[model samples]
Structures are given as structure tokens and as C-alpha cells.
Target: MAVITMIEAQKRSGRFNIYVDGHYAFPVSDSVLVDFRLYKGMEIDKELEGRLTAADDVAKAYNRALDYLSHQLRTEKEVQDKLTTLEIPEDTIEQTLKKLRDFSLVDDAHYAASYVRTMMHTGDKGPRVIRQHLRQKGVGEKVIDDALVLFTPAEQLAVGTAVAQKLAKRYQHNSTRNREQKMRQGLMTRGFGGDAIKAMLDAVDLTPDVDEQHALLAKQGEKLWHRYRALSESERQYKTKQALYRKGFKLDDISQWLADFGESVD
Candidate 1:
């Protein structure tokens, strides 16, 4: 048996160091000290000391979890990950998570819904992108699916159109075909499905006028001309024609430009 020789407050708030047999034993939160009614001259056996120590660990783990949650809404897995990184024992982490759930502080469903809303309204993200982000954050599939119910097809089209329109404006200087292609690639990278991308493309007026087409052809053609300047004239024309073809320009347009530039076709 060991006798409590002293109790002293720690420099950190809400914690105290205990002394047993005139030597330092352990530090515990104020709540743990009060719950265990620790005081000087109290006698404790090894088993009781172990129990108090475990209880103090639980209290500390719970407090740390609370502090982590206080800053923002967190998914259960996110909270678990943070506690695990802190090196809290598994059983204590489970207990802390249970308490948090009971108090409605950590709920995956709620977190998923809020996440979807924020991404749609503020981040301008589509459902697929939002779902991918939630999955990466360790939210369950069912929870993610349920949360995505809020993003209806009509709503998705609206958001997709808004995103596509912005990109279209940004690429207004490019040819119609190049601008449309860029817009599609950008939306695909952002996780919009093919159908959604098609819908957005169909809605946008991407047709270039005669002047715009001529300007784009002149700009791109000059670059290609310089690149193939070192090649034989015949090879240069063939390669430049192939290059412009791959860039979504019609063959007729390329032929017309070649003729206007006084380049003879084989």
C-alpha cells in the first residue's frame, strides 16, 4: 500500500500532479481528481492506482477529442484518425467517440450533408466530385449516397452550366472547337459525368463567326508554320494539315487557308 503524500496543481490548466509515498505518482485532470476524491493521506493499493491511472487517461483522451471537434464539424472517421495520431489507446478512443456520438457532436450523415451543401453552393462542385472528396475523407458510401440526394439532376445541370459558361468566357479567344474541347476537358476533370458534360456543351453557344475562325486559323497556322519551317515544304504542309485536323479544324477550312497563303497541295 502507498499513501498519498501531496497533491499539487500542474502548470497546465485543469490538471494536477499527485505524489504517493512522498514521490510523484501521476498527473490527472481536475475532473478525474474530483471523481476519485484524491487527497493527501489517502491510501491506495497498486490495483486501485492502475484503475485511477486508466480513468485519467480516458479523461484526457476525451478532452483532447472535444478540443479537436470544437473548431469545426468532423466526420467520425476524421475524429478517430486525429485521436489515433495522438497515440490514444483504441479502447479509450472508442469511449471518447461513443461520448461524442451520444452528445451529437460527431455524425457522419450530418457531416456528409453539410459537406455536399457547401461544395454545391460555395465550391461549385458537381455530385461526382463531392462524392469523391467524401470518400477520401472516409465517409461511408451509404452516407455519401444519402447526402447526394440533395443534388438533383436539374440542380446538377444548373451548376454544370454555370461552370461551363465561366470556362467558355475564359477561353473566348480560342476557336469554337478548341474552346468547346477545353470546356469539356475541364468539366470532366472536375468529376462531371459524360452526360452532364454533353448537356452543358449542348446548352452553350460555342459557334465561332467568320472573323473569329479566320483569326484563330491565322494564329495557330503561324505557329505551325514556324514549327515546320525547317521541314521540306511538302512535308511541312502535310504535317501542319494533320496537326490542324487533330485540333478539330475542318479539312475544307485548312485547304482554304493553305490556298489563301499560296501553298500548293500535292
Candidate 2:
């Protein structure tokens, strides 16, 4: 057994420095002090001292966890990983997590749902992208699935069509096939599924009329013409035809443009 020789308040708020047998022993938050009823001249056994120390550790760990959560909403795993990084003991971390969850401060389901809504409305991300992002954040599969239930097929089509229409307008200079292909690739990259992309492409008007095709040919043809300017006329014609064909122009369109420009494939 040891006698508590002194109990002095520290400069930091709500903390106390305790001494046992005339020597500094440990520091504890006021809550711990009050809970244990520690006072100068009180006698305590080694086992009681050990229990008090453990209790103090839990208080400190809980405080640190609260500080971490003060910035933004975090998933349970994020908080667990952070506490682990701090080297808190596994048992203490579990206790701290229980406390946080009891207070509803660390709900993975709520976090995942909020994240999905924010990404869908503001960031305009698809379900696949949102799923991947939630997975990376350590949200459980079941929670993510439940959260994604809010994104209905109709909603997916609405978002996918808006994105596809934007891409179609941007690439209007390309042939219909080329414009559709680019739109598909762009939607897929943004995390839209194949079915959604197809639906969007089917609904949008990507066909290039004669005037649009002529405009595209003129714009692209001028560059190609300059590129093969040094070649023989026949060779330049062959190269330009091949280049336009690879760029998704039809054979009839290329042939007419070549004839109009006084160039022959032969």
C-alpha cells in the first residue's frame, strides 16, 4: 500500500498531478479524480492504483477520439484506424468506440448515406464511382449497398442522359458513330453502367447533317492537307482519305470531299 502525499492541479484545465509516497505518480483528468475519489493522505493498494491508471487511459483515449471527430463526419473504421495509429491499446480503442457509438457520433450507415447524396447531387458521380469511393473510405459492403438503394434506375438515366448530352454537343464535329463512341467512353469513365450509357446514347441526337459533316471535313481536312503538302498529289490524296476514314468519316463523304478538292484516290 502507498499513501497519497499530494494532489496538485496542473496548469492545463481539468487535470490533476498526483503524488504517492512523496513522489510524482500520475496525472488524471478531473473526472477520473472525482470518480475514484482521490485525495491527499488517502491510502491505496497497488491493484486499485492499476485500475485507476487504466481508467485514466480510457478517458484520454475518448478525448482524443472526440477531437478527431470534430473536423467532419467519419466512418467507424476511419476512427478505429486513427486510434490505432495513436497506439491506444485494442481494448481501450474498443471501449472508446463503444462510447462514441452509444452517443451516435460514429454511425457508418448515416455517413455512407450522406456521402452518396452529396456525391450524386454536387459531384454528379455515378453509383459505381460512389461505391468505389465508399469502399476506399472503409465503409462496409452492406452499408454501401443500402445507401445506393436511393439511386433509382430512373435517376441513373436522368443523370447519365444529362452527361451524355453534354458530351454529344461538345463532340458534335465528329461523325455520328464517333460521337456515340466518345459519349460511351466518357460516361463509362464517369462510372455509368453499360445499360445506362446505352439508354442515354439512344435518347440523344448525335447525327451529323450534310452541313455539319462539311464543316467537320473542312476543319479536319485543312490540317491533313497541310500535313501531306510535301508528298506527291496522289500520295497526299491517299493519305488524306485514309486519315479521314480512320477518323470515322464514311467512304462516300471522303470521296466527295476529295473530288471537290480536285484530288483523286487513284
Candidate 3:
């Protein structure tokens, strides 16, 4: 580790600039080497000062990634996953993560809370659904529980209520008993819980509700209808009974709904 005192600087070529440190030091890449001695009789070698500068550059890249992340609310796993996908070095990614945590920039807990808040404020999404989303985003159960502060019974019920009302209006045509069951199935599919859905449906007036059960019933009808076409004339009646029964349709309702479609003649 030789320390040289830079004395003067002179231009040697279009790309070469020599730094005179009592003698002459030539720039080779990022490092400077002095071969001639001017102060007494001494020669030395020293590594370039690019090491610290390189550290700074890498730090900036990490900061840039964090900055892009902070421009929006990102889940912790989501950001880390992205950096991993970008092939950022593990050390650099760790350094960036530490800095972000220090600045309170990537709190998974905060993100969970924020996500729940946003969903509740916008529409009738239940806590169960929101929790699943937060968990998928790498938020822990503890953090999600903490974030569930706002989704009280009434709040949750309100969500169920809103969704049920919309469903009722949308499916007002579900005249048969199966209509209610199908709506219940749909709410369950949407991640609303049984208790919430039961409470909501119990509160809702089915009379004014639209026939949401139509699509499901119609889909079942299409399947049974297809099977009815495939059966030979003799087996037609038996197959229609078997198909509609397998489709979970009410024996009487199937007969009633499709009667207008007319039966095939032998």
C-alpha cells in the first residue's frame, strides 16, 4: 500500500492524462501507477480508489429499485420477488432491503393494513378474501390479524349485504328453490363465509331478487339437453331422467322449465 503525493497533472494523449506524483503516474484502467521516482529513491504500487466508488454505484442501483417500489404500495414479497427476477445480486438486494426497512419503506404489516383499508373503502370484499390476498403477498398471519381491526362484524356484514344485494338484483329470476342455493354457492365461491352469506341471504327478500340461478340452471339444461339428443328414441325418456337427475336439477322443475322446448317423437 504505497501512498503517493500527486504533484501535477498533464495531458499526454486524447484519452491519456498523466498525474505527476513527484514523478509520473499513468492511468491504466481505473488504477494509476507511478514508475519514475522524484522524491529521493522510492517506488510503490497502490490499488485504484474505485472500490469505495463502486460500492456507492451499487448502493444507488438498490436505492433506485426501492424508489420505484415506493412509488406505489407494494407487498414485501412482491418487491423482493421482482428484484430476484431482475437478477440483482443477493448481497445488493439485502443491502437495499436493509435500507428500505430502516426508512420504514417496506413494512409488510403496513402494506397489509393498507390493502385491507383500500379494499373495504372501495367495495364489499370480505375479510376472508382480503386476508387471502395479503397472505399471498407474503404478509404473515399476525400482521393480517392486526390489519383486520376495521373489518368488525358490522363491517363484514355490510360487505356481505352489499354483495348479496347486488347478486339478488342481478339474479332476480331465480324463481325455484335452487336459485337460493346457487346464490349461496356463488357467494361462497367469491370467498364470503357461510355465516356471513347465511346472515345476508336471511336478511334479503328473495321475491324482489333477480334470477341469478338462471345461468347455472341454464348451463345444467344445456348439458342435459345435449344428452337427451344423444340418446336413441327408446332410451330417450330414461336418459332425460338420468341426465337431469345427475345435473342436480329438481325432477319436477326440469320437467316444468324445459316443457316448452318440446319432446322428440319416436
- Best of the candidates, TM-score: 1
lDDT of 3 at 8: 39
lDDT by residue (181-204, candidate 2, tens digit) is 898999998888987888988888
Pairs clashing in candidate 2? none
Q: For model 3, how does the per-residue alpha-carbon lDDT over 115-200 read when each residue is reduced to its tens digit? A: 77787778667777788888888899999999998677777777777788788767555444545777787678767787888998
Best by lDDT: 1
Score every model by TM-score.
Answer: 0.87, 0.86, 0.64
Show the colliding residue pairs in model 1.
none
Better of 1 and 3 by lDDT: 1
What order do you get sorting by TM-score, best first? 1, 2, 3
lDDT of each: 0.88, 0.87, 0.65
The model with the greater TM-score, 1 or 2, is 1
Candidate 1: tens digits of C-alpha lDDT, residues 42-98:
998999889888888888888988899899998888999999999999998898888
Higher-TM-score candidate of 2 and 3: 2
